[model samples]
Target chain A: MNATPEQVVELLRQTNFSTLDWAIVVVYLCVSLVIGVWVKQYATDMAAYIGAGRSVGVWLGVATMTGTELGLVTVMYSAQIGFTGGFAAFHIAVIAGLVTFVVGATGFVVAPLRALGVLTIPEFYERRFDRKTRVVGGVLLSVAGVLNMGLFLKMGSIFIVGVTGLSPDSGALTVVMTVLLLLVLAYTVMGGMISVIITDYIQFVLLSFGLLLTVGVAIWRLGWENIFQVVAAEKGAAGFDPLQGEGEFGPEYVLWMLVVGLIGCAVWPTTVARALAMESTQAVRRQFMWSSISFTARFLIPNFFGICAFVFFSTHSTEMRELFLSPLPGGASSAFTPSLYAMPVFLGHLLPTGVLGIVAAAMIAAFMSTHDSYLLCWSSVITQDIIAPLAKSEMTDQRRIFITRLLIVAIGGFLLFWGLFYPLEGDTIWSYMAITGAVYFTGAIPVLVGGLYWKQASTAGAFSALLMGFTALVGLEPVRQTLAKTLAPVMGDSETIAAALSAERCGLAALLLTCVMFVAMSLLFPDTRPDARQRD
Target chain B: MSVWIMIWKVVFVIALSAFAVLAVGATIGGARDVVTLLNKLKQDRSNTKSDQ
Candidate 1:
């Protein structure tokens, strides 16, 4: 039953993607583009363009919300954790669903946000604090948001390469990244959120069918008992338990997942845009409450796929295992993506021919839907919040839309360049995303929670908390290494320094420090504005 | 699997089943809403065209 290495290579070649497969992907892309262009007439103003006129009904909201949030990069990273950490990784998804459900039931942050009907989160800041605070928040948010999206193109391309049997070092990777970016940019630049919502609905349908099919096939092909058996045999208790300190996740790591789970759905702009775009506060609640399932499945399903990959590789012969994890020719381990390629590579062998094409197309849809939403989100924030606020004159709806389109192009350009250049090392792609996003959410969460609930929240407090979030800059490999080198003499060991300032610690530290700063500054310099808490 | 793993397995099942139920119900509910909204949009657009 074990696949020899040659059989693995042969399997990869057999499913090298047929003409029909490419046609399916192309047709999906064309349909999305046509829908985007078609929707432009509906987006007649800034509200229609950026927030879909705040008219999105519940089902449309649920579908689009899932489409935007359950991005291909999300799948890639969740699966990566599954392959690396096994079933213990499922905790992340459980926490995600539970937090989202509690938030919905309690109407914690999102309900009030929906009630305010602000097009963007910073607009709330402008109302609660001041325009200057809004502008500063926008700048920090865009910096973090844009960087957060930077790796998206690279991760998506990696999936395509891994799925379709393209050489990791091939020119094909760059070509795929460019083509996917262009497809997303075309529709996004044309119609904004109107386009995104339509495309996302369609993508939701395709993505759901694809995910369901993949899960069924995986279960049938590799019986449920066998998957757990192999993982257990190869890894023992560590594979099944995240609580085990010796595995990838420790106490700090789990604590960080708790923070990330709360922030990912609750505070992240892309997800919150769905809340802001909904027809009513009630619709927002129902959407989140309904979406709790997809939230859990989003990470749970992909993590399952990744766990399957680990099991598949482990059960196979040694050479088959080496095919994925082995060092590149004339080099150490692969500097690019590394063992993260295992999931799609394993799937390529597992799925039948036409089915493979559908799954790949579905992921492509996911990649585009997410890119479109993110591109629209960050661009709109920069235009309405950062640029428009600082400008001397008010922007017309047409001008605002024009500037937004131009900014989308600029951000897409940066993503392509960043994706090509940034070499991921040491950290899993999921951790990379969490830490980068913490740069924004770590500070933003407290500012939002306090600004909404706390009576004494001052502009000074909000600003200082945002600045404190920069403490998480230690999560960056280069930044961590630089600081470690600088402190090595004092610390007695560079490795110890690296271990001390891990991504989990940095993120936790950032969140705690920012929370403390927000509280302290608000109490120290209480805002005297009578209407500050009430807002516009 | 240990008792801890068994507990987690149960948790995963319950969570996944709950999500499936919610997602399916939402999907049907959401589709109905979409149809209604689209019809309204169409009605408004035609009304504007008639006025013009």
Candidate 2:
């Protein structure tokens, strides 16, 4: 009684997506392209190209920040969390919002960084520590950032394929990923941050409304009271309480989330890029304060959709139950995991044709907005932080912009390749993203905090902390598996060891280790020059 | 568990409401900001050309 892939496709095809939806999606894509290309006139200099001339206002800043952070990949992963973890997943959203609010109010890391007026975080390293630290920090940031977004194209393509009821075997994932990448590269390379900002504003409007509308429809379809009842019956106490260790999340995971939440707003490059792009440090603070709402909604809304998807699947048919709920026979797996497809498939069935198209377009907007920002971000870091600094001669603005454009295309090509070949075998997409990001932030936290606040933070401390971040790479599933096997003789069981070295635990350990390394190294090798440390 | 459920429900509602206000406010305010940004960029380009 195992369902075949064909049978699963047939069940998925019972969606409300239609020709109208396709047309809507196409029109939206065309508009985004035009706006992105049209903004090229404004990108005449390095600052304009990469930082939108540092002229962004508070509201636009908020919109673009939300647009970038609340990406389609974010939606996919958060929904998966909601579907599997139920109400417990809400804790992550709560933590993200609260942490973001605190950062905004306290002006902890972002405001000071904004006050420094550097284009990238690594640039600050050169100013405070040394040129070598900047190059090392830049390299690590680019590597971790590029790796962090490796799965984005795959997740976005999955959402498109699942929502449109396309056959998983129809080669649609590759097609969608390629087209999306090309489109994002085309505009991002041309208009840079100006293009990113304009499109992000539109996307913010569309995605916010689309999310609210879809949630309203889903609540209507599955009665709110009944939705809770189903979760209670299916998942029990663990569904409601995140602190209940019976669920996917526990105390350790919550602590890790608090750290991740802080990094999401304060330390993450793309977000901090928005802060840097603002008209003033005050604007950066206000933008983050206002963006706290979107931060919460980004996770809370998608997670609700996931819970709804779970309810829909549980009640619908025996076929769905076999596909999604039941354990696979003999540990066989599908080309795509069923849990990842749950929210899009649920929306496919719940929304009517016209609404489905608008929502689909909005989701595509979300995908593109994030892609453009990230592509622009990593490429700029490579140019300004890595290549330009290391160059024997000063680079002209035109040459810098040209190189950045070339790098955007190159990065897009890498994304396509990585998306196709890399197996998404981790427990949750969220955990995978967090751990990948931890490889950068675990080290960055100590360096950024110590450098900004502590006068004693030496160049040696910064280098040691940045180098220590590489230890988090072992948290990746494939690496963890390899490690577990190597230690199996000593540890008794590979599976047990693998499970013991969970992504959250490893990430927490890396953060703690990096912090200690930073402090110890700074004390051991204090800078001799009194003027080395810059004061605010 | 019930308390947890209630807490989530409240948080969800507040988040939704706040986001709704933000969407509308940012949309209107962002439109004006976009115009300001473009004009500023234009001015900067003119200044650069004059200097050159």
Candidate 3:
């Protein structure tokens, strides 16, 4: 909503999204840079740079893991789900927490991977299969990972736009996206994982306060009972019932949530990097166990904010309410309305000035922590698994660090371009993330599990399984749309068929197909004799 | 369905409480650890300088 001169004066007086918040953001960036400078000298070796010299303790481990996982993009998307899906969105959190807790309790895939002491997931592929498999896995992983991160810049910028009331088409969107990227890349390129860990602890503390304050403001401004009542009234049984058909999450989605929870904590590379960086296997387990709370709270809190935004917009006067309620029926190809901005806009109205500044700073912390860790994680994989293997001679530590830094900047540049140009079309950002991530994790889950556990897992089986995961591309909305039309004669309705191809169903199908391929390939081609590595 | 909702609500309450306790514990524990780590790193840097 455009503020009148009087309204603008009143908003500035009341602490709306303003220059003071930007100052707060700049201060947070400076603090992070100082921390980066302080930590830079320690990252002389690749081991120290990539894995913090495998010395992260329980608390620092939890703090860094939480900071890394709970990105501003995470909050934005979770809030989107909550805004549209109502209380049904809580199921994702419950599933995420429960799965992470289970992994922590059982020392599942992660515990074993840590015991193996691999720097990246593909490094495990090399040990179990062959060097060739590792290189292929690395290439596929980096591509999928980079693609998966493609939308983070845009989604994060949307949160800033919505909250700070920037025009969507304004060049400021590009500027914000670029600035956040440079800040994160600069620190990550300087100190690597060591710098990421130090900054994360600071970010974690700020994030906790900002998180609690937002939820408190949301509840205080809109009564909790009223929030639930409006959802129930507007959405009925589906609003409160995650398992029912009235909402977006039903049994299929819940089943999908189970897969997400498992892969997220166990099979995902970045989170697993934390476990690999820990002091001990037990510490790794304890980290996940302690972090399960942060995982759950991360989703639950933002989701609550989204629901509150929905309620607040429903009651309050603004241009945002109408746009949020607009039916953007063109789907994936359609440009998004301001609905994604609703939660942030609500925060701008609710928070007073200094409090707004603090929350904004906390969010900046969230943004940097996630980006730096991800950039480091992805670039480290490209350096360690992909390029280091290709080089004729053993790579010097300096060269490895140099390559990783260059890759980080390159990736950052790509993200800026992708964020600006990528057409989201019909799918939700969260769903898009799930589908793209499945491109790697779907294949990796079966291969990693089989390699780690099942004695029959072979090089042939691993290659086949990883290749089979490419079929998950069908899960993307555009791909589904194209396929639906191609098969329309048999499918009956193109739109129905397209709509039926949810990311959850597509992922499960990919997992199953890859599992079959792995088992079949391994059994049929039975290694003349099991490799010694396999037996070991 | 109501049973399912009840089950989830109960589970959520338990999970939230458990998570809150763990987060608090980790934060306190981690803060102390971070201080010690930075101090040790500082000592190592100084020792290297002296040896040089």
Candidate 4:
């Protein structure tokens, strides 16, 4: 029998939360709270709070960094990508790791950034070039970071609402969102990097165990052959083929993922802060390389999960279609929650009681680890890097800590609102990230490279590169939509303007244009010689 | 196959040398000591530069 939506609903209904699941989430939450608060005892000063006192050894940093980069979204999205596109998603990990290695090896970003002792990426811009550059870069990074985070609150709440058996639109999503955000803010605001690093370490441990459990269980239930067979028959050539499955979105859709993940990987302020947290350039290189390895392992896991989801759903499509497409008010078709519910379905059906609890704990751990670090990373950048500079007197560490906490709450509040209203269209979390990332990655590249290599890369040049990159990236939405509408009648393709313009070629084109403009503008208006840029 | 495994093992060992530093950070005291040491290094470098 062909898979139907009814079967999917049956599957969803069949997989209700058990006592074991509750135990897992509760134990994990308690452990997280303890680990988080415990780190505060070591946080004596601002540096400890912000940068692990720059004493973070390479392994711990690598482990934590890998864990942070691969959060709940990674698990969900990688699986979604795998389910749909198969090996193509796997290629992305390989591509991302290789680029990371190249950049770390060649001093593409790290060397100059580390040497500056700056707290945020924009601070580097401000110091290397001008205030205008800092402001532009800062604003862009924040917007991109926040908007990209739109899914986190919604997804987190969805997980809670789904697991707890609350209807999707039950007003409880907001409450769950508030509670989780508060938990992250509490530890992050208290200890800064100290709390962040310590909690991240603990989180890394739990998340790895969770991943292993999931992988092991999936293998056990389906057997490798069964999983592969299902995926092959269901997804057909397109599912297994790395290159197919463009659908209504077109090729630019997939290409954008690669561009954004690769470029934006280095562009985040937290990443730079983590790099600077190390003791030496050698340490920075080592941390990132190992982190890359950890990332490799972490990245592959998601694709595996994604592929598994595809197989599972394809085989059970009849059930899912009925479950999802039924006339339920405020509830999306199971497809809306497919990736979110993928693991839950597997756990409820496949695992025995004790093991199920442990895996669920791991899942929560994975989510919290990423969320806490993000809170710590962003708040620190805003308070120490941006706010303090604007203040007249040197703010005390106490004041700084207070402000960072306040900002975390403020940012969390803002995200709560966004998550509540913003609807998910397409597999958007990653796409939004990629598009925004192109802005940051390409923008920072010119200024960073010029700061290191080109003697003639004036402050004006840096400023212009930053401004142009920011403007171009931020402006892409309108320009793309307009272009899409304009071209819609001409070309019969149903592709949105965003998808049409996001081709890898378009991304590369933007990169080239930005680089040339930066050079031209800088030479036309010089700020500092390359020799002068190196202070000592 | 053995040769590839051997190569990876050697790489892992080298990576462990770096890992040793991070392991030190596991302990609160050890992490603090490392931070203090880096600060001293930064200060010494600055002092030497000024002397020159």
- Isolated chain A: TM-score per model? 0.96, 0.98, 0.94, 0.88
In TM-score terms, candidate 1 sits at 0.95
Count of clashes, each model:
1, 0, 5, 18
**For every model in order, what is the iRMS?**
2.4, 0.7, 2.4, 8.9
Query: Judged by DockQ relative to the true structure, which candidate is superior, 1 or 3?
Result: 1
Model 4 alpha-carbon miss at residue A428, Å: 2.9
Clashing pairs in 3: A331-A425, A331-A426, A332-A425, A332-A426, A333-A425
* TM-score between model 2 and native: 0.98
Per-residue lDDT tens digits for candidate 2, residues A1-536, read: 78776687798788999999999999999999999999899899999999999999999999999999999999999999999999899999999999999999999899999988899999999888989999999999999999999999999999999999998777988999999898888899999999999999999999989998998999999998898899999999899888887798999999999999999999999999999999998998999999999999999999999999999999998888777777656444356588998999999999999999999999999999999999999999999999999999999999999999999999999999998998876658888899889989999999999999998999999999999999998888998999999999987899999999999899999999999999999999998765243443
Identify the leading candidate in terms of DockQ: 2
Better of 1 and 2 by DockQ: 2
Q: How accurate locally, in lDDT, is each candidate?
A: 0.83, 0.92, 0.82, 0.62
Model 4, C-alpha of A536: deviation from truth (Å): 4.4
Worst 10 residues of 1 chain A by lDDT: A328-337
Which pairs clash in the backbone of model 1?
A: A59-B30
Binned by DockQ into CAPRI classes (incorrect, acceptable, medium, high), candidate 2 is high
Q: Which pairs, if any, clash in model 2?
A: none
